[model samples]
Target: MSAILPPSQRLWWKEPVERIEIVWIAIAFVWCLILTFMMPYWHVFGKQNLSNEAYRTTPQAFAAKAQAVVDKWKVREVNGVPVVKPPAGADIYLVGRLWQWWPAYELKKGESYRLHLSSMDWQHGFSLQPVNINTQVLPGYEMVITVTPNKAGEYTIVCNEYCGIGHHSMLGKIYVVD
Candidate 1:
């Protein structure tokens, strides 16, 4: 490679970097250090963390629990689907199976609810559209999602994960009432 360059230009690589280049290099190093310290600092001090609360239960056991929630809340059949309007600050249960999300709920606006979501057959997605809250529903694991609807409207719940040929038909609803 030295044979391709003239003798006068061969000493360029031996020279030190300029002062501005050194300053930029130092700046980049400090920036990297700052970024490296951010994650642990956030974990210790920030109010942001992933929810790791989950429990193991069979599909049958979960179904019984869901039925208890439904029976206790006075579930009504709306066009062959169950719809429950539980009292304020009540815990709600939702069942997800192949191509279906059962027992739509009616929630009071500005009231908090603990939604216990589980799957009966396969992995599914709990996606509330228009509001855009999404979470995964896995079989044998109950995932709890806490939400308080601030706006009064009907939010469509659709499965965002592909489960089967009728995956597109997996839909539900949550009515946020005034």
Candidate 2:
């Protein structure tokens, strides 16, 4: 190796050989990221047709199952209290108003609640973080998402989709297990 050069004369990072190595490394890193997303266990993204692959069940086999959930999800309430029976599972709901949540909704330990989410006005994003998750709550249309509270702690439900000036502070709390 040659003696260390002054800052102005240094060429270690710009060598042609090192440049090629960096390119190859970048390519390999991107390829690994693509593969990691396709794996079944990681459902954060690129998890296509989850039920079919995870349960080994075809579309036809799931007909009854889908109908069952739809029937139960048809009825819903505004806040923690249920207007109708909440299908015996974990449920999430989002508000269309900016910087506001219903303010209170608590989950019980081990017990599950069915999450029925929708927007009262415009399209809103319902995110249950610490879980790396989000779901769209569209106006006049309902989307039902199910969650099981595995860990007991405080979690934030923030709006991931842009709404207004208060978008950053649009947060709510979920206490799992009490």
- lDDT by residue (63-161, candidate 2, tens digit) is 344334434543443444222223345344433346654433556656666555545455568788788677665655545544566778777788888
Compared with the true structure, model 2 gives a TM-score of: 0.49
Model number with the top lDDT:
1
Residue 148: error of model 1 in Å? 0.8
RMSD per model, one decimal: 5.0, 10.2
Q: What is the TM-score of each candidate against the true structure?
A: 0.76, 0.49
CA error at residue 9 for candidate 2, angstroms = 49
Top model number, TM-score: 1
lDDT of each: 0.85, 0.56
Candidate 2 has its poorest 10 consecutive residues by lDDT at 48-57
